[model samples]
Every structure is written in structure tokens, then in C-alpha cells.
Target: MEFRHLGRSGLLVSEISYGNWITHGSQVEEDAALACVRAALDVGITTFDTADVYAGTKAEAVLGRALKGERRAGLEIFTKVYWPTGPGRNDRGLSRKHILESIDGSLSRLGTDYVDLYQAHRFDHSTPLEETMVAFADVVRAGKAHYIGVSEWTADQLREGHALATELRIPFVSSQPQYSMLWRVIEDEVVPTSEELGISQIVWSPIAQGVLTGKYLPGQPPPDGSRATDENGGRFMQRLMSDEVLSRVQQLKPLAEQAGLTMAQLAVAWVLQNTNVASAIVGATRPEQVLDNAKASGVKLDADLLKAIDEILEPVAERDPARTYETSPKERP
Candidate 1:
């Protein structure tokens, strides 16, 4: 697999990292999840990303069990905070109490003392920025985390957090956002700001919630058991599941054939083409899906093919810079 540095840090992560967001403990059984993890390892993917809120905290435990035998030094495991993991008032947000306690819970559940990178899943409007950054710095000083990152943050938020991290002398190395051919919200602002500040993007949903896979056909009830039918992830796919979007996505089949890539591979490869993207996170319910996505890690698309992809998908793509602001929770959950 091809590897790239995470932002400006010396740490290198696989270009195609494995992540378990919707399919780990909730959608797939333990055995299936374990097999997918094994498939990722067999194909040379060494990075895994998860969030504390995913599947009610079961995702982290499942991933922890799946990686039990591997040498810890060889893998880069990442997790995030800033979501409601319990019913208590203080169980959520980036407050110092939460981050400090949350890190320990994550470490114990993951069967590791420290995560390679710990991220804020979303910006906590309720918490003071300085308070949050200081908590993160403490986590690093305590050896509970090696680096810090934020997800779905706007350019201004990134700039604000980056400055505080610099002041604290901590490694704020990565940004996690949803990026794909169909979702271009991060392009106009976040990309430029992150590039300027030396923060690389570890993008999720590179296939636009499976819309770019070309499986959800236009004018047809989605094929059985597809993401459209999934209760857990279906709500997030609503923005991309329109007939117009599906029709446009269908037009890319020929381009996929011409480029000699599966639609999914083409989608994943498209995100890696952006120089500021350090990695693209892929999640799978089956082992073969992992094998197929790993191949996209090192594939390079030519300029003409890229232009063709843009032409076909541009009409349906969401490029508004304001969309990034809409992604974050307005209030801490």
C-alpha cells in the first residue's frame, strides 16, 4: 500500500485507512468485523479510525479485539471525542473533565495505553476553545495521545484551533472531513486553509455514502440491503440519493470502464489526487470490499480522466463553502 505523511508530521499513514463507522458492532456480527480487519491487514493497511460515539461505543471495543495480536508499534490507531457517549450532562462535549476521562476509557477499551491520534469529532460550540486545546495538550503530555485533530471544522475554526495548538506547542496534524467527487464543500475554503496551516485531511465518505459506487440505480427502489436501505446510515445518504444525482452518477459507469476502475475505486482514487489529503477512510461489511478498496491506494488517474469525472459529476456536486458550517452540531449533544 502507498503511505503518506499525516499533515506535516513525520508519522506516515497508509493512503487507504480502514475505519468502522456504521458497520462494526451495530450492522455486522463480531466475526464479520474481525474478518474485515484481517483483510485490511493482509492488504497492508495499517491505519484505523473510529469515534467514541460510533455504535454506542461498541465500535471501538470491536476494533480493539480485532487488533489484539498485532504489534502495536506497527499500527496507527485513531479515535475521536466530542459526541454524547452517555446520558449524563457532563458525558459529552470537549470539556476538560470529559476529554481526560474519555481518553482513559478509550485506551482501556482499545486495549492500548495511547492512541496515535485523538480527534474532536466536531467543534463544541459550548466549550471555550482555549479550554479544549489545553485539555488536548494535557492528554499529549500525559502520554494518552500522540497528536490532536478535529473533524468537520470550518476554515475559521481550524485557524483558531491551529493557533492555540501552536501556542501550546502540540502537534495539530490532521483534519477529518467528508470529501468525495459528489461532496465538494471542503474544497473552496477548508482545503486552502488547511494547506496553508500544514494540516492534512483524512477524509471520510470518499464515495459519498456509497452513492458514487453506482449501485443505487436511478428510478429504481434501491437494491435490497444497500446503504439506502440501511436504517443507521440511510438518513445521511438522503442528500445524495435524488434521482438527478443518481442519474448523473450512472453516467460515470463508462468513465469507470475507460479508466479500468470499479466505480468505488474511481471515487476513492479521486480524493487521494488532492495533495492535501493524507488518507481516505474506507469502511466495509465484507472482506472482499476491503480488498477492493485497498487497490485504490496506489492507483493514479490521468488528467484527462480526472477532467471527465468532474464534467460528469459537477452538475450534481455540492460545492458551497457554507455547507461545512452546516455539518457541525449547533449545540453539544
Candidate 2:
């Protein structure tokens, strides 16, 4: 697997990282999850991303069990905070109290002393930015986190956070956002800003939540056991199942066929086309899925193929324009 710097931080991560999101604790059994993790490791995927809120906080525990003993030391683990873990108000957000408490819980669940990257799952509007930054700085100083990052933050928020981290001498190494052929919102501002600030962009849902995998057809029923079947699957994903998007995805199949690659591989390679992207965090339910995704790491997309893909998914605008910017210290660049 090719390695890239996690922003300007000196830490190198695999271009295609493994992530436990909707599949680990909820969709797949423990043994299946363990098999997937092992398969990822065998293929040189060293970076693993998870969130405290995924699968009701059980995802980290499953990962910890899977990576117990010496296996834990061989990988760079990343997890996020800010989503509500319980009914109590104190169970969420980037407040000093919440961040301190959440990190301890994450460490205990992951069976690790420090996370390679600790990200804010989303901007917390209720808390002060300075308070959150100071708390993150304290965690870095205490060695509970190796680097800090944020997910789905806007350009202005990233700039402010970078400024604060610069003034405080804390390193903000990466930013996580939803980016793919089906969703190109970050290209307008987030991508350019991160490139300028020397922050690596780790993208999630690079396949548009499996819409680009060619499994979902324009007029057919949702595939069995897909994320679209989940109760929380929102309108954005519903739109992804539309005839227009499926037609666009179909247009790319010929390209993948010509390249001797799977549709999923083409989708992933398309995401890694940008040099600013450090890694694309992909989730898998089976060992073969992990292996399939690993193929994308080595599949280089030629200029002609890229132009074809852009033409197929043209009129390229932000998928979710309703998501506006919110300021917070947990936000990163």
C-alpha cells in the first residue's frame, strides 16, 4: 500500500485506511469484524478510524477485542467525539468536561493508551471554541492523543482553529469530511483551505455510502443488508438511490471494466486521485470486502478515465447544500 503523510505531522498512514462505522458492531458479528480487521492488516492497512457514537459506542470495544495484545501496537488508531452517548447533556459535545471524560472512555474501550488521531465528530455549537481548544491541548500535553482533527468543518472554522492551534503551539494534522464523485462540496473551500494549511484530508463515504458500488439499481428495491435499510438512513442516501445517480454510476462501470477493476475499486481510486487526500476511510462487513477495497490503493486513474468520470457525474455541485458552517474549537483544518 502507498503511504502518505497525515498532513504536515510526520506521521504516515496507508492511502486506504480501514474504518468501523455502520458495520462492525451493528451489522456484522464479532468474528466477522475480527476477520475483516485481520484482512486489512495483512494488506498493509495500518490506520483504523472509528467514532465513539458508532454502534452505540460498542464499535470501539469490538475493535479493542479484535486487536488485543501485540496487534494493538501495530496500527494507528483514530476515533471521534461530540455525538451524544446518552440522554444526559454531559454525555456529548466538546466541552472540557466532556472531552476529558470522553477520551478516558474511548481509551478504555479501544484498549489503548493514546489515539493517533482524536477528532471532533462535528462542531459543537453550545460550547466555546477556546474552551475546546484548551481542552484538546491539555490532552495532547498529557499524551492521551498524538494528533487532533475535526470532521465536516467549514473553511472559516478550519482557519480559525488553525490560527488558535498555531498560537497555542498544538499541531492540527488532519480533517475528516465526506468526499466522493457523488459529493464534491469540499472542493470549493475545505479542500483548498486544508491544502494551504498543510492539513491532510481523510475522507469518509468516498463511494457515496455505497451508491457508486453498482449494487443499487435505478428502479429496484434496496439491496439486502445494505446501509440504506437502516432506520437512520436519511434523505441524502435516498436521493443517492435515484435513477439519475444510478445512471451516472452505470457509466463508470465500463471504465472499471476496461481497467480490469471492480466498480468499488474505481470509486475508491477516484477519491485518491487528489494529492491532498491522505487517506480514504472505508468500512467493510466481510474479509473479501477489505481485500476488494485494498485493490483501489494501487489502481492509478489515468487522465482520460478521470475526465470520463467527471463527465458522467457532471453538474458537480455539493450533495448536501443545507449543511451550513458552524464555528467551534473542535473544528480543524
Candidate 3:
């Protein structure tokens, strides 16, 4: 797989990194999860992204077991905080107590002493930004994590956070956001601001949660066992399952053929086209799916095709810049 520097940092991550969000420890059984992880490593993927809130934190344990024998120095493992991992009040948010304590639990679950990157899963509205950043600084200083990043944070929030990281001498090197052909909310503002601050995006849902793969037909019931059919995961995907969006996505199949890529590869490559995107995080249920996605690594799409894609999907896509902040919880969940 092709590798690119994650933001302005010297660290390089796979162009298409393996992420276990809905699959590991929930949708897929442990054996299937292990097979997918092996498929990723077989295709040269060295970066893995998970979260403490994913599958109630069981995703990390499964991932740890999957990568048990690999050399730790050769992999870049990432996990996040700020979501409720337990029933207690201290079990969530970016407060000093939570951040400090959460990192230890994450490390233990991930079977590693330190994570390559530790991210705030979301902006903590109740906690002071200084408290959060200072906690992150402590995480880096104590060698619990090598870098700090945040997910789904607004442009203004990124600017403020970056400033705090600079003041604290922490490496705030990456932004994790939901980005895809169907989601352009980050392009108008976050991309420019992150560029100025030297932060690159490690985008999730590059395929628009599989909508871009053309598997969901317009006005039709979602296929059996699809993400849209899963009660828990389906909710997040309902917004994009509309007939208008599905019809528009279906229009891209010919473009994929024109580019000699499968619909999924086309979708994955489309995100990496952006210079500010360091990696596109992909999750899968089977080894074949992982293999197909890894092929998108170095494929380059011409400007004409990209323009055609925009013309087809932009009208149906979510581009309102404020939608970024709107997606973040009004208060911590």
C-alpha cells in the first residue's frame, strides 16, 4: 500500500488504513475480525484506528488480539476518548480525570503501553478547553501516546485547540472526520484551517458508509446484513439512504468503470485525491472487502472525472460548513 505523511508530522500512515468501528466485537465475530485484520496486514496496511466507545470498548481488545504478535514499532495504532465508556460521570468527556484515566484503560485493552495517536472523539462542551489540552499534554509527556488529535471538531475549535497544543508543546497533528463524496462539510472551512495549522485529515466513511459503493438501490429495501439493515448501525446511515442520494450514487458506477476501479475503490480513491487527507479509514466484515479497499491506495483519478463526480453528487451532498458543528453533540453524549 502507498504511504503518506500524517499531516505535517514525520509519521507516515497507510493511504487506506484499517478501522474497526461497527464491525469488530459487535457485527463480526472474533474469528472474522481476526481474518480481516490479517487481510489488512497482508496488503501492507500498518495503521489501525479504533475507539474506546466502539462496541463498548470491546473493539480494542479484539484488535489487540489480532495484532498480538506483530512488532509494535511497525504499527500505528489509534484510539479515542470523550464518549461514555461506563455508567459513571467520570467515565466520559475530556476532563483531566477522564483523559488521564481513560488512556490507561485504552492501553490495557489495546495490549500496548502506548498508542501511536490518541484522539478526542468529540469536543467536550462541559470541560474547559485548557483542561482537555493539558490532559492531552500530560498524555504525550508521560509517553502514553505519541501524538494528539481530535475527531468531528469544528474549524474554530481546531484553531483554538491547535493554539493550545502549540502553547503546551504537544503535537496536534491530525483531524478525524466523516468525509466522503456525499459529505463535503469539512472541505469549505476545516480543510483550509487544518492546512494552515499543519493538520491533515484521516477521514472516516470515505464511501459514505457504503452508500457510494452502489450496493443500495434507490427506493429499495436495504440488502440483508447490510449496514443499513443493522438496527444499531443503521440509524447513522438512514440519512444517506434516501432515493435521491442512492440514485445519484448509482450514477457513479460508470465512472468507476472508466477509471478501472470497483465502486468501493473509486470511492476510497476519491477521498485520497484531496492533498490534505492523510488517510482514508475503511472498516469491513470480510477479508475480500479489505483486499478490495487496499487496492485503492495509489490509484489517481483525473481532474475531469473528479469534476464529473462533483457535478453528479454535490447537489445531493451535505456541504453546509456549519453542519460540521451541528453534527457534534450540543452537549456531551
- How far out, in Å, is residue 174 in model 1? 0.4
* Cα distance off (Å), candidate 3, residue 85: 0.5
Residues 56-78 of candidate 3: C-alpha lDDT, one tens digit per residue: 99999999999999999999999
lDDT of 1 by residue, 1-333 (tens): 999999889999999999999999998899999999999999999999998889999999999999998999999999999999999999999999999989998998899999999999999999999999999999999999999999999999999999999999999999999999988899989999999999999999998888999999888998887877999989999988899999999999999888899999999999999999999999998999999988898888999999988888888898998988987789987
How displaced is residue 76 in candidate 1, in Å?
Answer: 0.3
- Candidate 2 achieves a global lDDT of 0.85
Which residue segments of model 3 deviate by more than 4 Å? none
Candidate 2 least-lDDT 10 residues: 324-333
Residue pairs whose backbone atoms clash in candidate 2 = none
Query: Candidate 1's C-alpha lDDT?
Result: 0.94
Error of 1 at 193 (Å): 0.8
Segments of candidate 1 deviating more than 4 angstroms: none
lDDT of 2 by residue, 1-333 (tens): 989999888899999999998887888899999999999988999999998998999999999888787465668999999988877868888899989999999999999999989998887778888888889999899999989999988888788888888888888989998888988777878888999998989999888888889988877888877778876543448767778778778878888999889998988998898888999999888899889989899678899888888878885335443243522344321
